[model samples]
Target chain A: MAAPESGDGNNGAARMVTLISSDNTRFEVEAAAASLSQTLQLTILDGGGGGGDGIPLPNVDSATLSKVLEYCIKHAPAAANGGAPNATAVDRAELERFDNEFVNIDQSVLYSLIMAAHNLEIEGLQSLVAKKVADMIKGKSPMEIRRTLGFPDPTPEEQAEMNAHMLEYGWAYE
Target chain B: MSGTIGVTLEQSRSRTAGPVLPENHVVSEILVRLSAKALLRCRAVCHSWHRRTSEAAFLLVHHRRQPSLPLVTFLAAASSSQSQHSHASLDTLDLRLPPLIGVGWTPLPRLADAALYLHGSSGECHILRCKRRRYGDHGLTTNAPAYHVLTIGSSAEPRRIELASNAPRASTWWFRCSERPGILLHGCLHWALHSSPEKLLMVFDTVTESFRSMPSPITGTQERTQLLEMDNTLAISWMDMCETTMRLWLLQDYETGVWTLSRRIIFPVTEMRSVLNVKWCRFYGTVVSQERYVLLHDSHSSYLFHCDGEGKLVRKFCWSGAVPRPAGHIGSQRASSGMSSSEGNMVLVRGDNHVSFKASRV
Candidate 1:
């Protein structure tokens, strides 16, 4: 499908594309925004996702796809500017604030977002979510981390091994 | 919390029940963002985390991802009047914390009898200390230097490594082991030895705990030079005392020891005079942060200049009269010298004075 030139004439109209999520939810977004995902960039560049067929994302659910698109749309302009060397300080700060707020979601949503971002090959989203997870893991003990990550109670043998490790690395606890 | 002690928590309680565990690659990504100490603590999380974190591949990835904050460890005499007894201390200017007030100075346990001097540290925070054997009433029976490597907070005792017989010995006052910190790269720590008529690079492989020497990139130059690690490769930077020119050479091929002259920078006469009023001064340069900036400090003065790779001045900082100098120390001879860390942080060590500057990108 050939992308129809935007009618604005100066820079052409913003080209829009349709993305179909796994659960059959359809999200219409700007082509530039959807192209932020390296996986989708190729298909979009090949003139896919421009028509009624819409690009299908089998690995990502509707909710996760929407969340990922929100990030791509917010970051697309800066990405298009080749890292936005000319971006104003306010512009950069706004994006940073947007990013921090974007990841402030439940752990379950964050996990799905991480998986979707990875499958879609969205570099910024992957890094943001990974850092969030790291923050949650920092400072917590192994048992706390196990609980936070939702691990089952340790078996007696596993508990014995953990106790031995704690004895060996007692300084870390201090 | 007591009621929950023996209860088996189901996966559904976890905020996300998609999978019991994240993929190994995802876990590695998260692990890389953690600090070294935090990562060590995480080793007890599970057997899988322990095995993954211990892999050499994961270490390299973590080193690359984490910012290299320059930390300075030095020995300070117990008192200004008494130079005999000293204690070791470490301080780091962590930028992740708030500016100016984030200095962490921890006094390390004192080494018994012998004076311990900091030689260098690896990116993994493995510190190498040289125990200078002091002669008492017994008189000098053995003068060989003793070396030890230990990580901070590690329960394992520091292990001593025997220096090879062929290792260059410091014989003269002027040629005391180069004040520069060891350059850690490629699983080895490298130090430049200033031997008369020839300067040799001494390398210690952290893996094998063996010592070997390699020829300096530029030989037979009377100019002062320092060895530094840049972009995972060994680099040497030297200043021409006669002229205001600095030459940087990088060992492009470690296996072949082939050095390519990467950059030749000429300092402006005015900028040079601002740092040093004298006509001739010894300056040592180290490439900081992806070869973008080179940090140069005058041997005799506390003034430090941060310049671009091309030798243009970006900014200048001076410790000047405020820096506590050991009494009777002559010339611009500093007890310790400054080194650039992986992320462009400048670490300056002299006697008890340890200062680190967060890299200001120009």
Candidate 2:
């Protein structure tokens, strides 16, 4: 495990905030980075999550919280530029590449990230995760989808329905 | 990242009979991103997915996002073991979408045998298939082959009604009814009662699974009238290429059945003609876009002319012998060129034993 840093004083005296995950793990992150979450933006605006009182995020676990923070930190610079209207194509492409890599984790961790992203009201993250999931299931056959999403073997009635569905839309079966 | 990267070991997709990934947020978010074909496949996953995708509000939202791309329908003949007589089936090749992407054809295997005419979309693809050894001399149905309406991917099979074999008047319809390809408009497949302008337009309403006649336009149909959908309205283009002029009429308001002569296109005789005495093949077809850009190509598909709504020539796009096989990829190239037209069109390139065409509303 990599040692956790006190954010390494990268910004000298920039405002830092602490977040407490559901498991009571405290994470210290830059205020601007944490503000990417609409849920946290307001509390951070009122000078909250400063000094000792960390924002309590009961819906997110430490792992998901760390993942979300990493994304926020990476994206905060671009967001601070007001949707980066002046940002070069290379910069946007770099961010896109990072984002593609960020979501390339295990399925369980990915689902948890989606839930955490949703709870935090991070619109970009939610859409990114949703698109990833959509791409995974697109063009897949019913049985393949059932297995991919971990759906159990269909009961007799469900099997009949599946059969009927296959009969009707067999052209779509890939 | 290591400490809880192991979280997946206990609760990945391997975990069955537990909390599934999708909530309402995730389902709608994910489902909407899927294509129409993918969504239909996704509906078979489970009851929750099936019901969620089936919701009317969700369907409307999903449909709005779908690209109204045109499809190339090719009539391919194949022998079916289910029936003694060889039959022809309507197969559509996707113009834009991937995998098939104009190159491959998605044949309707279920509706393969004896399927003659393909029409009526939106709710379901109503396939009109004929059965029994009851074909007239000119490859037309002498009487009825027992009209079996196969509603693809929707409700129960509509009751089969054999258009009473004893009815002799039905025999006159042998040319138009059984042979001529039906034009789809407003959820109905329409056929002219007679080739003459005086006859009423017969519509086989796919929704009600019944037949009804819509009165001819107030100005009456023009000679050699061909139905095409333009800007979401039914249009007829009367092309007597021999006279080097075409008349176009649009149904402004369908409820009132008002027909307005929109354009009178006069084709230039000097350009685009066959080597021998200006002979035009049946393979040549026309399509009008929502922007009113009219496209007509030669029988060889060698030249494509784009004309304005007023029948004035705008530009011309041509390619080498595109398809003695199946032609559709030209559409993408056509888009890249100027005049970005918006209606879906396909051309029916006649092959050895098959025929294909591009038209409005597929």
Candidate 3:
């Protein structure tokens, strides 16, 4: 699929891009938004294939693909708008609020986001997802945390072993 | 075939979708970063994760990432010179390990007064008193005060022991020391001893069964020794003889030769009566914790002293003393000495103000 490029005919602004997902889906995103992914941008630029073929992203599904695009779109504007001429506190506050809302999804979706961000080399998004998952289990008990993480049940002997290990190695004596 | 396909699509649509990341990898990654408290919680969630995290190897790995360094203390009979002895000649216990749990403590080997040194993986402790016998006019003045050492690891076994000093007469003992009443500080056992000459502080290593002398945190300033252990840090409180002013000092890590001067806590000294003669003046004891150290004064008054990562005192609480103290405190009747244990948050012992108690940190 051919990605559409919208820019004034200028030497420095002419850039092309392509994207693909794990399920054989292709996305023809603008170079501006596609460039948000350093991995994809570097790959395309290195290949020197301008306005040619779709970018192959063999890991992301369409649902996650759209979400990544939304983030790229939101972030691209700020980068293109001269870094918001000193981002206002309100603007930062709004961004924080949006990020919180964005991560409010179920753990399954969050896991997908982590994978997509990692595969796409979106460091900021990947860290956000990892931190969010960490925060979710911060205060939870081992059992609740295990259940939340969908861990299997331990056998009686294994439980004993764990308890013994904690007794032997744990530093709770402080 | 078309009807079957439609039914299959409907069934797939109705199923609830869970996150797509492989459960094993994600679970392991988070478990690696969880704190002790959080990990404890995670243990209860399910059997599989609990088993995985409860392994000594896994917990050790986690501990390596974030270790818990505790300050062990001890209590013993004080000597006449007002100085503590080394635990180099006594048995030792190894209290140091990879971080595994929170606030849990393990007792090191305990030794008697006449031992050499104690060394352990966590740290080393030594007896701080010397046998002093004055012989002149009155037959023989046997004024040698007694003291002991409680170390972190078992020193009875053959291990490369580290001695605190490069003194020429470095000796080693084989007998295992009895576990006395005191606290563990920085993995070494600490105790207090009282005698006619003066008070003494005792520390011992459990691993190498060696010992060394612990110098006063307040080196130059002459202060009545009153020690406490908060969290894994040591809080040594004293009153300068010259000014009768109170002060607190912290030993960050004796193994690393780190001694930090904590905030100075001054008490009012009146001229009507000798400040040193006050029996109840030494009733406050402090116990260090993760963020704040609890100070028990007059066997009732509880104050909190906050500390930073460097073990520097940062803040204090001004809550009034609690009524009818939770613990009993009795001073010696005659030239009786008072003692305070920083390990278990024991209240200050009135009367004899020289002897310090080393309670277990757990």
Q: Which candidate wins on DockQ? A: 2
Instruction: Report how far off residue B265 is in candidate 3 (Å).
Output: 11
Provide the DockQ value for model 3.
0.23
lDDT by residue (B36-58, candidate 1, tens digit) is 65776777787777777876457
Error of 1 at B244 (Å): 14
Q: What ranking emerges by TM-score with the best candidate at the front?
A: 1, 2, 3
**Each candidate's interface RMSD:** 7.7, 5.3, 8.2
Q: Give the TM-score of candidate 1.
A: 0.59
**B1-362: candidate 2 lDDT, tens digit per residue:** 22222223122344375435644456777888787668778888776777777665565456445442322223322322333221122122222123331343443212122222234344433445444447667776555435566543445755574443333244344222212335555656655544443445655665566666665542222224555555556676666646466677787888887889887777554454542236554323344344544455544343445566665666654333232112111121111100101233221211111111112221
lDDT top scorer = 1
Best by TM-score: 1
Q: Distance (Å) between predicted and true CA of B256, model 1?
A: 12
The candidate, 1 or 2, that scores higher on TM-score is: 1
- Reference-based TM-score of each model: 0.59, 0.51, 0.44
Q: Candidate 3 docking category?
A: incorrect
Instruction: Mark the 10 consecutive residues where model 3 chain B has the least summed lDDT.
Output: B328-337
